[model samples]
Target: MIQKLQKKLEGKLPGIESWKRMAVKSGKGESIESESLQKYSDWISKDKLNDMRKAAVLIGLFKKNDEWCFSLIRRPMNEKNHPGQIALPGGAREKNENLMNTALREAFEEVGIKPEDVQIIGQLTPIPVPVSEYLIYPFVGVIDYEPEWVINEDEVEELFILRMSELISSDNGYTETWDLRGNKVEVPIFKVMNETVWGATAAVLSELIDIAK
Candidate 1:
């Protein structure tokens, strides 16, 4: 089944235009189950969104022991925003680079995966992150071999290897309540490697899974 799914994914991925349409139709916060629904409600306001900082993340895929997998990083607790959160390999965009370059550069810096090794496939919806005041662009890519990750200990607390089969399984999704901004709210997340993945990271993955369908 995994091999079959992999073949299907390799056939034809949606292009940039499809990504744009998907971004608008992604249902924003309402699509992905999260505690911070209010912030995403205003995601469609182009004027306000344009004022926010820009960032990018890479959803990289590779094969391991005949199974498709991806990588996620746990941010160090001392970071200013989204401390100790589970995230894709990415960061804020630099002044001289495009979104794809930002994603590739950040992934290399954080995980030590060489930029040349990654084949840029496409991208998912661009989502606005209110807490960080940045509009994050999510790009999808694939590598032919497993990476020998050299994690930057200062920025990354730990590395997570998540399998595509687990992500697409019905049992992986769950709802849990957490105290956020003085309010106890219910957040939908994917349970992977005994960790809770929520917020923007989960939102992007949720859209990617939808696109795969």
Candidate 2:
């Protein structure tokens, strides 16, 4: 499974490469066909938003054995904002955190994934949702010997170990076509098992799917 991901997900990709590529499109008034990602290399490279909202890193840990394969998760429904949805182990970013650090911290807090156990090999592009006014970063991390995960019952309902082969072949996600204030918007979401992961999570997952597939 790890080898499979390494092929599907880049072992390494540059932050600035994305920005340079995006600049080309901006100059010609061409729409960005890129999935969900920022043209800017870093937070400082982009135009400063009136609201500088921060977000967390959603990490997917895939494990497989003789007959089982799954990714880690925390219940999104019943949570304050993104309630009862299926999602990766991540949350809001803390002050003075690098994007990678924020992801590691959130994963640890949400699923008891130790920072040392998970090795981050690469990251997906930045996903910013205008409605939420936050930029979300997604990373690909690997953990050997799945640790004993204890969900923070206060914030999470349970830990879902989702199968990968099934995810790849079965219903991996969803998409919604709607209009926001008369502007047509098509939002895509992922159906991981019974959980529906949408918004920034779905966008980030889309990128991972392209690179990893």
Q: For each candidate, what TM-score against the reference?
A: 0.80, 0.68
Identify the candidate with maximal TM-score: 1
Query: What's model 2's overall lDDT?
Result: 0.58
Question: Which numbered prediction scores highest in lDDT against the true structure?
Answer: 1
- Clash counts for all predictions: 0, 14
Give the Cα RMSD of candidate 1. Answer: 5.8
Question: What lDDT would each prediction earn against the true structure?
Answer: 0.74, 0.58
What lDDT score goes with residue 155 in model 2?
64
Which ranges of candidate 1 are over 4 A from the true structure? 1-48, 170-173
